[model samples]
Target: MKTTGSPAGTGETAGSEANGAGGAPLRLWGGRFAGGPAEALAKLSVSVHFDWRLAPYDLLASKAHARVLYRAELLDDAELAAMLGALDDVGADVAAGRFTATIEDEDVHTALERALVERLGTLGGKLRAGRSRNDQVATDLRLYLRAAVRQVAAVLTELSEALVDVAEEHVATPAPGMTHLQHAQPISFGHQILAHVHAFARDVDRLRDWDRRAAVCALGAGALAGSSLPLDPEGVAAELGFDRAFANSIDAVSDRDFAAEFLFAAAMIGVHLSRLGEEIVLWTSREFGWVELDDAFATGSSIMPQKKNPDVGELARGKSGRLIGALTGLLATLKGLPLAYDRDLQEDKEPVFDAVDTLLVVLPAVTGTVATMKVRTERVAAAAPDGFSLATDVAEYLVRRGVPFRSAHEAVGALVAWCVEHDADLGEVSDAQLAAINPAFTPDVRDVLSVAGALDARSAPGGTAPARVREQIANLRPTLAADHKWAVG
Candidate 1:
C-alpha cells in the first residue's frame, strides 16, 4: 500500500492521496472524488474490524437484493445467477477465514463489495445500483441480531433448564428465605432456585417479543430515501425471511430501537444472572456454609492454599455492568441523531455484537455452575429455623384458631420479643411461656413452629410447600418446552 497525505500532523490536505498504484483507496466511495479521504479520516472511518462480524449477514442481504435487481431488470437472469454464486463463494471464504476485510475496505459492506467485484468484475458493480450502505448495514444488523437473539435465547433455555433440574432435585430441601438480607421465612430450596428460572424465562420471552419488531427488512430504503427503481421491497423481504419490508425509509435506516431493546434485554439477562450469581457467591461462602462449588467450577487462590473462590459467579456479577454499559453507550450515541442514518450509527454493531458474545459465553458457564454445585442440606436446614423465621407460621396458626389477625400478630410480636430477650428459638417457648406471652399462644402453636410445618402450611397454589413445588415444576416443564421450541425457531 502506498499513500501521499498531508503529513500525519501538518494539517495538510490528502484529497489526492492514493493507497495503491491505481490511486484508489480500495474503498467503495472514492469514485465521486478525485483522490482519497484524508489518512486520519480514513483510519477513523474504517469499521471492518468490528463490522466484519456482520459479513455473513451482509452477503445474505446482498443475495436478496440481487434478486430484486434482476426482477427490476437492472440485471439480467444470468447476471443474478452469477451474483448469487459470487456471494455464496464469498460467504464460504469468509466462514473459512480465507477472505477477510482489510482496513482500507472501510466496512463490511465495502469489503464484501470488493470481494464480489474481484470475483465477477463489472458484473459485481451492477449489484450496487439501487442500494446504499445505510440500508445494507441496517438490514445486515437486523439479520445478525435476530440470529444473535435466538442464540442468546437458546442458552437462556439451557440455564433455565439447569435451574429447573436443581429445583426438582431439591424440592424438599429446606432453606432460609430472606428479605432485606435477613431471614424472613423457611422455604423449599427448590422454590428459591425456581425463582431464578422464572427470571430467565422472562428474558427469553423478551427476546421473542423483540424479534417481532426487528423482523422487518431495510434493504430497499436505500440511503434513507426509498429507492426510485422498480423495486419489490416486499418480495425481497419475504426472500430474506423478514416479517415485512420497511414502511418508512428514513426510520428503517436510522432506527436503532431494536438494537437498544436487545441490549436492554441482554442487560436484564445479565442482571438476573448477577442476582443468581450473587446468591451463589453467598451460599458458597463459609459464613453461609449452605453450598459448596464443584471442583471444576471453583477457583484456587495463588497464595492461599485453602481458597476455593467462586470466580464464575463473581464474573457473572461483574459482567452485568459491562452489559448495561453497552445499552447506555448505544442510547448516548443515538440520542441526538436526526432522521436518516449518520456515521454515528456505525457505533451500533460493536455493542450489539459484544453483548451477544458476552451472554453466549456467560450463560453456559453459569448453567454448569448451577447444575453442579452441592448444597449443604444439614446447614441449610439448621439455618432455616434460625433468626425466628418460624414466627410468621405462629401468627398464621393463631389466625386459624379464632384469634383476630392483628391481635394474633401482636401476640406473635411479643413472643418474638421475649425470645429475643431470653435468647431462645421460636420453638423453644414452653406452654408456660406461651401463657405468659398471651392466652392466644396455645399449646398447639408448637406444632406450626416446626420447619416442615411452616413450609407445608402455605400449600395454596404457588406456595413453597413440597407438593405445591412439585405442581409448580409440573406446570413449568411445559412452559419451558414451549420456550425452547420458540427460542430455537
Candidate 2:
C-alpha cells in the first residue's frame, strides 16, 4: 500500500498544528480535516502520558531509520548527520526530563517528531520519509519489551537464587509435605522451596524464548504494505539488536502475540508467586507456624497491636488477578480485528505496562521476604510428625516387604482409621496393633515410622532425602549461575 499524506501536504504540514499553537489539531492526521478533534475525542485518543515511557526506544528506531533513509538516498549525508545530532539532543532532553509530551502531542511518536522538527526544522521532517506511526510504534514496543524481558528475567534470577540460598540452609530440615491441604508425607523444606525455584526457572525460560520472537523488527512495515523506498529492514533490525525483520507488513504492525505471550508469562509468574505467597501466609499463621515474615516485608493491622501481616505475599496474590486481567483485556482488544493496524491496538500497552510494573515491585519484595523471614524449624519439625504423616512410610515399608501396593495401601488406610479413632499416632501403635493390621508386622516396622527415617527412605533422585536434597542444591547452584548470566545480560 502507498503511504498517505496529510490533506494539506506531507506530514510536515501537519507538524506545525501538532505543536499546540492556536486552535490547531493535536494529532499528525489533523491536516486531513478542516477542524480539530473534539476535546473528548482528543482526550480519549491521546496516549503520550503512558507511552512517553517508550520515547527512548522511539528515538532508537528513528536513528536506525535515518540510516536507512540515507542508504535509500532520500536523505543526504549532511541531512543524516543533522538528524542524528538532533535526535541526540531530543534524547538527552528526554533523559533529563526536560523534554515531555504536551497535550497536543497525541503519542510518543508525534511528541518526539515535534521535538525533532523543533530542533532541526525540515531535516527532522525527513526522518519520516518511509516510516509510519503504525510501523514505528510496533518497532518501539518490541524494543521496549525486549529490554523489559531481560530486566524481568534478571529479577527472576535473583528470586531463584534467593530461594536457593534459603533451601541450602534447610536441606536437612524435615517438614510435613501436604496434598489436598492434608499431611501426605515428610519432605525436606529445601525440596519444597526448590519446587518454587523450578517454576520460576521455567518462567525465565519462557521470557527468553519469547524474546526470540520479539526480536523481529517492525520498522520497514510502513503503514500497511511494505515501504516503497529501498529500505534495508534487516540492517535496521541488526542496528536495533534484533535478529531479523518482519516478513509481512500487515502482520508486523497488527500482531500482538508477543505482548500476549509476555502477559501470559507475567501471569504465570504471578500464579507461581501467589502460590509462594499463599504458603508464606499459611506458614506465618498460628495454624501452621512454619515461617515468620520479616518486619520490613510485613505490615501491621490498622487497629491491632499484635498483627504483623504478610502484606507482600497478600499483594502478590492480589496482583496475580491484575496480571490475568492484563492478558485477558489485551486479548479482548485484539479479538476479531482485520489484518493491519487499528486504534484499538493502542489499548495494548497500559495493561502490559501494569503487568511489568507489578512484577518489578512484587519480585523484589517477595525476594526480600524470603531472604529475611525466619523459618521456624522447630515448629516445622514438630508439625512434621503430627496428623498421621508417617502413614505413607508404613505403606511403603510394607511394599518393600513384598506386600502389593494396593494391599499395603489398604492396610495403611485401616491403620490410619484405627489411629484416628483411638486418637493416637502411628508411632503410638503397639507391635500387637501392627500385627493385628497385617501379618507383616515386625519390631523393625517402628524404625521407618520416624520423620528422619521416612525422609532418609526417600533417597531416590528428586526425593526429599537429605542426600538427594544436597545433591539437588549443588546442581541448582550452577544452574542459577548460568540463568543469572543470561538474565542479567
Candidate 3:
C-alpha cells in the first residue's frame, strides 16, 4: 500500500492535488502507471458515483470467485477463510457507509479491490489470480440485472393488482370502447381496466423470461479465452444462484446480449406503461372527464390557477423513449464487435442501469396512482350513451331479424348517417323511423341500441359484457395472485 505521491489535502486545495497513499485515494488500478491520474480526470472518468449500486453484486461475485479459487487449491483453508471474512466485512462497510469510495477508482470493481487489498494485504491479490475484469464485470452485471428484474416484476405485480382492484370495483359500469379514437361499442369499464392489467401481466412474465435467460454465470470466463487454472465455473454458478454456466468461455465474457435482452424487456414494459399513462392522461382531460387523479399524483402549473396536470403520467410517457433508446444503443454497440471482450462493451451498463432505475421509480408510482384513482362512473355512463357506441348492437339486431350481415351493416350505416345529419343519437330515432330505414329493424332495434342492451348482447368470452368482464376478472384473479406470490416469494 505504498505510494510515491504527496500527502493530499481535504478542501478546495486538496481537490486539485494527487491523492497520497493514506488519503483514501484510488490505489487499485495504479500498478502499471507510476503517477496518479489528474485530479480533474479522476473526477470525470470514475464511475463509483453511480456504479456504486454494483457494490453488492461485486461482493457477491467476489465471494463466488474466492470459493472457486479455494476449490482449485490456489488458496489454503486459512487464505480462503480470510478472503471470505474480508469480503463480508467489505459488504458490511459498503452497506453501512463506512467505506470510502474515491473518484480515482474508475469503477466499483477497482474500488472494491483497493478496499479488499487495504484490509487483507497481499492475500487480497489472490482473489483475482484466475479471473479478469472482463469476466468479473460480466458476472456483476448479470447478478445486478437478475436482482433488478425481479424487483421490477414485483412492482409490476403491484401495479397489476391495482388495476385488478379497479376492475373489481367497476365490474358493472359501462364505458365507451373506442377504435381509431371513435366509439365502437359499450364495454364494461372493468373490462377496459383489466385489459391493461393483462398487458402488464404479460410484461411481468416477459421480465421473468428475460431474467432466466440473463442469469447464467460468466465468472470464470477470464478475459475471453479459457483460463489456464482449473476453476469450476459451475461451482461459481451454483454459488450465485445461476441455473447454468456459459458453455463458450469467449462468449461468456463478450456477450452483452443478456443485457440487451433485459433492455428489450424493459423497453416493452415501458411501452405498456406509456400506453397506460396515455389513457390516464386522456381520461382525466376535460373532453373525456372519465377519471380523476388523486391530488398527490397531480401537479399544478404556476401560472394557471385551474391546472392540475398529470405530470407523473406525462413523465412516464416520456421515459419510454429513454428506455427504447437504451435498447437501440446497446444493440448498436454489440452489432459488429468481434467475439470476446471489447472496451466498447463497457458502455453497456449505463443504459440498462438507467432503465432499471427509471422503471423502479415509474412502476411503483404508477401503481400508487392507479390504486388511488377515482373512476367517474356517472360521467363515463353519460358519455357512453352519446357516441353511437351502440351502433353495432343495432346492426346485430337487424342480423337477428333475418337480414344478411352485409345488408344489416348497410342499413345501420345509413341509419347512423341520418342520425348524424339530424344531430341525434341512434337511440333518439323512433322505432317507426328505424323500421322505415330497414323493415328488419323491429321494435327490438331501439331496445338493442340502448347502451346496456349493447353490452348484454355481446356475451361471448372476451366480450365487453358485464357478465363476461366479471368472468374474465374472476379468471384473472387466481392467476395474477399466484404470479404475485411467486414474484415476491
Candidate 4:
C-alpha cells in the first residue's frame, strides 16, 4: 500500500521548455494595444508556470473547437486536415517534453496556439476565430476536473476499503463510545470504524452528483456571448463527452460554481479523514494504548529515543486545515467579482488543483496507517466498560423490570456516584449495595453490566450490536466495489 506524489506544479517531471524565462514579453491579445504588457503587469498576470498542467485539456478543447469550426465552413477540408495535423504534433511535443510554456506564453491556450502558428504559418491562426480564452479556459478547467474527479474517487475508494477491512475484522470487539470526550457507553469497535466509512461513502456520492451537475461544455460561449459564426456547440459538446452545451453564454464563461463545488467536496473528504486520523492519534497514545501503528506508518523523534510518533495521523489531522483553506480561499476569490470573466478566475485553479493534489497524497498514507495498525483487543475490551459506562444498561434493566423511567435513572446515578466515592469498580458492587441505592437495583441488574451484554443489548438496526454491525459491513462491500469501478471507469 505504498504511495508517492509531488506538489501541484512539480509533477512526475517538468520539461526543459517549462523552465526558460520569456525571451521577450508576450501578450495573447495585443492588437488593441500599441505595445506589449508592462513587466509588472506581465509578472502579475503570468500563469503559464502553474497552468501548463492544463495543456492536454486545452489541446483537447482546441481539437473539438476546430471540428466545430470546420463543420461551420470556417476551414476547408485540406485546411482542416492541416490544422488537426499541427494540433496533433503540438500535443505530441507537449507530451514528449518537446514543447512547453515559456514565460512569453501567457497561458496554456496562448502557448499551444503559438505552437500551431509556428507549425502551419497563417493556417494555424485560423483555429482561434470563434472562441475566446475566457471560454477556452473555462472549457479546459471542466475537462481537467471531469477527469480528475475519477482520480479523487479512486483514492477515496481505497481509503474506504481500508476502513471496512478494519471494521470487518473487529465486529464483535468492544470499545468505548464517547460524547464530549467522556466515556458515554459501550460500542462495537467495528461500529465506530464503520461510522467513518459511512462519512466517506457520502463523499463519494457527492463527487458523483457534482460531476453530473457540472458536465456542461463552455466552448461555444465565446467571451460572454454566442458567436456569430455557424458553430455547432452541441456537436462540440458531444465530442468533448459533456452532458450538454451550457445554456447561457455569460454564465458559461463567468461561472466557477463547479470549481467551488469540487473544493467543497474535497474539503469534506479532508474533514472526514482528519476525524479518523484524530482517533488514531488518541488510540495510539500511552494513555489509550488501544491501537499501535505500523513501523512504516509511525515515526520517531530525533532526540527523544523512546518516542514513537503517529506522524501519519498527525499530518492527516493537520492537512484538513489546508484543504479547508483551499475551499474558503476560493470562495473568497469568487465573491463580489463582476462577471463574464475576470483575473480573479485565475485564482480558482491553483487552490482546487492543490486540494486534489493534497488529498491524493494524504489519503494513501492515512489508508496505510489504518489498514496496518495493530489493535490491542484486550486493552480495548478492558476500557470499554470503564467510567461506569454500563450505567445506561443498568437503567434500562430497571425499566424492563417495571420500575418508572425517572426512578431508574436516579437509581443508576446514585450507584455510579457511590462507586466513585468509594474508589470502587462499578462491577464489584453487591446486591446489598444495589438494594440500598434504590430497591429497583436487584441482583439481576448486574446481568447487563458486562461489556458484551452492553454491546449485544443494542440489537436494533444501525445499533452497535455485533450482528447489526456485521450486516452494515456486508452491505458496504458491494457499494465499495461499485465505487471503485465507477472511479476507475
Candidate 5:
C-alpha cells in the first residue's frame, strides 16, 4: 500500500519516508511481522472508509496527545508546534474534502497519522508516543458521539417546538382519542399533539443523562492498560470537554454502554416518531380526513393522477424498523466480546452512525410534516363524538349522580349495547332508555353526552381539557427552552 501525498505538501510521501523494506506503506504496528498482510486480509481489516468520519475527532485527540508528549518532555517546543501545525493542515484538508483515507490506511487514526507524517516528517511520528490505536479510537469515538448527541438533541428540540406550535394553534379543536383502535373519548387536538411533545421531552432528558455517562474520557487507557509515560489523563479529559477520565483502563476502551444508551434513546425516538407517523398516515387518509399533508412534505403517485401520498410519514413509520434493527444488531455485536478492544469492536460505529444519520434525515422531514400540515378542524370535530365516544361521560354522569362507579359502568355498558343493537347514537338515546338502565339518569345526563362537555369535564392535572392542555403547553415551554439552550450551546 502506497501513501498518497497531497499537492500542498513537499511531495515527500509518508511511504517514501517510512515504507517497509518491501516497499509497502509503514504500518503503525508490523515490526514483528515477517511480511505484509495478505491482500484479502488487509482489504477485510481496513475501516478507513466508514471510520474516516472520525477524522476531526482523531485530530483533536492527536493534538491533546501531542500536548501530553510536550508536557512529558518527550517532544521539544519546536516539535510540538510543528506537529500541531501539521495536524491543523490535515484537519483543514479533511474539512475541505481534500484529504481522504486510502486502502492502506487501516482506520481513521492510521490515515490521519499518515497525513501528519507526510506533512511534518518525524515530528508527526512523535505524536503517537504513549498512545495506542485502541485508546485513540475509543477517545475519537466518544468525542464524535458526544457531539452527535447534542446535534440530535437540538433537532429533537426543534421537532418538539414544532409540535408545540401546532398544538397551540389547535388548543380547542376537538379530536377523538382512541383505545384499542376504538374511539375512547373526545380530546383536544392540542392535547393529542402534546402527548408527543411530552414523549420527546423525556427523550431530551434521556440524552442529557446519557451525556453525563459519555463524558468520561478514554484517551489515557492505552491498549487496555494505563500508559507508561507521565501522561496527564485528567488534563486530556478536561481539554476535550470531558467530565473525567475512565476509572479503569480496561473499561475505558471497552465501554460501549454510552453507544448503546444513545441507540436506545434513538430507538425510543424512532418509536415515538413512528407513532406520530402512524397517526399522520391515518389522519391524512380519506377514511379519517383529520389532517391534510402539505404538498412539500407529501408526494404524488406515478400512475395515479389524483394521488397525494403521505410519503414522509410512511417512510418515518418504515424507518423505525431500521432503527430498531440497528440497535439490536449493535447489542449483538457487544454481547460476547471479551475485555478490552478487539477487531470485532470495529463493527460498532457504522450501526450507530446509520441510526443517528437515519434520525437526522427522518426528524426534519417529520418536523416539516407536522409543521406544515393543515389540520381539518371541522372533520376532526365531526368525528370526535362518533362511535359511542360519549359512553364514558355517561358513566361518569351516573357516578356524579351518587351511583357507584361499577354500577355506573355496568349501566352505561348496557345502554351502549342497546344503542349498538338499535343502531342509535348516544345523543339519540332517550331519557326513558337511560332510566331503564339505572335510576341515576335525568335529562341532565344529556349535558355530558356532548363532545365539548366531555372534553371539559376531565380537568385533572394531566387531563385532556382545553384549560389543562393550555397549562401543560405553558409549563412545557420553559423546559423546552432550557433544553434547547443546552442542546444548541
Candidate 6:
C-alpha cells in the first residue's frame, strides 16, 4: 500500500487532461462530457486515490467478463485473443507501476475499460457487450471483497493463535476477573486469553459467511434487467471462482446488502479487537502492572521519560470508531435508495475500501502485541486473593453438605458480612466464624476457596479449567487448519 502523502506524477492522459504521479487524468469517459470538470470537484470526486487497490480484482473480472462475451458470439476468436492480451498487459503495467490510471474514468472500472480500448481498439468495447457498469461494479466488488475477507480472516487466525500461545505459556498463572470494573472472581490467566481466542474464532466464521454470500457472480446483469445477448454468466462466474451466478439482474445490480453484511461483520470484529485492546492498555498501565509490553511494541512519551505507552494497543482501540463510521455511512447511503441503479451507489466503494484496509493493518499489530508481551505472572497471582470471589464457592460448599441452595446462599451472604466486619479475607475466617453463619460450613470449606480448586471444579466442555481449555485448543486445530486452506487456496 502507498503512503498517505506522496508526490503526484503525470502519467495516464485522457482528452485534454494530464496524468499525475498520483493517478490518471480524466480521459476515460470521452463520449459524453464536452467540458472537463472543475479542478476542485475533480480532485474531490476522484477515487483513484483509494480505488487503485481494486486494480488487480478489476483486471481479473474483466478477463472473465470478456471470455463470456466471446462465448456469446459477439466477438471472433482473434478479437477475444487480442482483448485478453491487452488486459494481461494492463494488469502487468499496473503491477509494475508502468500504467498510470487516468482520473477521466469515474473509477478503476472505467479507467481499465478505457485503457483496454486504447490498447485493443473497438475490440476492447466488445468486452462490455453484455455487461453494464452496474453489474460489472457489483461483480468487481464481490471479487475484491472475497479476497479481502480471506486476508482479514488469516490475520484474525494469527491473532487467535498468538492468544492461544500466550494461554499455553501461562496455563498455571492466576488473576482476578472483574465485572463492572470490580473484582468478581478469580480466573486462570490462560482461561481469559482463551476466551478471546474463542470470540475471534466466531469472528472468523462470520467473515467466512460474508465471503460465501459475496462469492455469487453478477456479471450478466446488464443495466436493470437480463441482457438481450446470449451471455453465459455462470461460465464467467466459474472463471472468476464464484460459486454461482446471480439469479436476478435487477437484484444483482440493486443489491448491496452483501457489502452491508460484510461491513457489519468487519465492524463487529473491530469492536471485539477494541475491547481486547482496551484491556491490554489497562493491564500494562503502572497501576495495574499485570503485563509488560515489549519495547518494540511500546512507545515513550516525549515529556514523560518514565512512561511506556501501549500506543499500538490504544490506537487499535481508537480505530474502531473508523470502522463504526464506515458501517454507519454505508447503511445510511443504502437506507432510502431507489435501486436498479443510482449514482448514490457510487458512494459505496470508499467506505468498504477503508474498513477493509483498516482491519488488515490493525489485526496484525494486535497479534504482534500478543506474541511479544511479557505477562507479570507474579503480580497476577498475587492479586488473585480469596475475597468476594469465594462467596459463590462457599454457597456451593454448603449446598454439597445437604443444605438447600437458597438457604446456603443466604448463609454465605451472612458469612461474607462477618468477614467484612472483621476485616478478614474469606480464607482467614475461623471455624467459629463459619458456624456463626451456618453449621454446614466445615473445615474443608477453606480448601474450596482456593483459586486452583475453584478452577478445577468448574471443568466442563467450555469451562475455564486448564484441562477443558486444552481440549478446546485441541478441537480448534483441525477447524482452523481447514479454514486456512480455504482462505489461502
Q: Please tell me which predicted candidate would have the highest TM-score against the true structure.
A: 5
lDDT per residue for candidate 2 within 40-142, as digits (tens), equals: 9989989988999999999999999999999999988777887787788788888887788877778999888877766665556678888899999999999
lDDT of 3 by residue, 118-137 (tens): 66655666787888888888
Q: Residue 87 deviation, candidate 5, in Å?
A: 0.9
lDDT values for all models: 0.86, 0.86, 0.82, 0.86, 0.87, 0.80
Residue 259's C-alpha lDDT in candidate 3?
Answer: 89
Clashes of 2: 0
What are the RMSDs of all candidates, in order?
Answer: 5.7, 4.4, 5.0, 6.2, 2.1, 5.0
Q: Judge candidate 5 at residue 321 and give its lDDT.
A: 94
Candidate 4: minimum summed lDDT over ten consecutive residues — where? Answer: 1-10
lDDT (C-alpha) at residue 151 in model 2 = 86
What TM-score goes with each of the models? Answer: 0.94, 0.95, 0.91, 0.94, 0.96, 0.91
Candidate 4: residue 142 Cα off by (Å): 0.7
Off by over 4 Å in 4: 1-26
Local accuracy of candidate 4 as per-residue lDDT tens digits, 1-489? 111111122122222222223433334576577667778988898898898899999888888888888888898987788777778888888888887777877787877876766566556667889999999999999999989999989998999899999998899999999999899999999999999999999999999999998899999899998899999888999999999998999999999999999999999998998898899999999999999888999989989999999998889889999989999999999899997789889999999889878999998898899889999999998899888899898888988999888998988888999999999877798889878988877787777879998888899989999999999989999999998899999
Worst 10 residues of 1 by lDDT: 1-10
Model 5 / residue 171 / CA error / Å: 1.1
The candidate with the higher lDDT, 3 or 4, is 4
Residue 238 CA displacement from its true place in model 4, Å: 1.0
